[model samples]
Target: MISATELPSTRPYLIRALYDWCSENGFTPYVAVKVDASVQVPREYVQGGEIVLNVSMDATSSLKLGNDFIEFKARFGGKPRDIMVPIQRVMAIYARENGQGMAFPVNDDEVSSTPLTAVQPEPVQSLPEDDPTPTSPSPSRPALKRIK
Candidate 1:
């Protein structure tokens, strides 16, 4: 049995919570992903080794946000395509309107196996503008808090 001390990663839970929050608040949810060999997405649309996708219900069909991966069918340039992204590859998920989102730190092991010398950093797309203005957190809006 798993002990309370050995908890699972909170990334997947946070993703689901944020996705639901965006949906309830009428905000378009978007996910930024780091592209690699394992990721299957439209290469032409990939910029700077990453791809930003709209995972809203209207934007995708048969969307499945699983703990290991997020799968969905979205149209690119009017052509339907299936997109698969590993949860570890998700850089951030945020509301497109207000830019309210959380960014995850990349683990060293998650880095590409290719040597740094041979790797070329692609121009990654920047996240939406985060409003620095402070706002009170309500029960309706999820916020990341650290417990000591």
Candidate 2:
């Protein structure tokens, strides 16, 4: 018999499925990642430690959605860069056109601790005509501010 700890994470499988779904339906697949020392991406484009990536087949090259990590090469400002994000650090994966996708609860713990679930509401900036790879998503703040 296998224990819960022995099971692989459902996150990677779901991410691949969503990517396929978006591809089959002509929707752009975007992944929102919580940036840390482990995540490799452009710091200048990252807004408040979070970055939204356009993972569509048209945008990325040598894309590999693996079990432990998502590896790909994409262009930022027309300069190609290798992007890598640990599967557990992904905050959400959704269709950029319709905002229809799934979100995972990202934390320091392992992905197997909790089952995959629906996505979160993170607003993104409108895409530009020439550049649509790195979307500047405003960071989310759950706390309210005091105003006079």
Q: Among these predicted structures, which one has the highest lDDT?
A: 2
Q: 4-106 in candidate 1: lDDT tens per residue?
A: 4455567778899999999999999998887888788999998877788999999999999987789999999999999998787778888988888886644
lDDT of 2 by residue, 1-148 (tens): 9766667778899999999999999999999887888889999998877888999999999999998889999999999999998888888888888888887767644443244343446655677789869853445432221111
In the order shown, the candidates' Cα RMSDs to the true structure are: 12.5, 12.9
Off by over 4 Å in 1: 1-6, 111-148
lDDT scores in order = 0.76, 0.80
- Clash pairs of candidate 2? 103-119
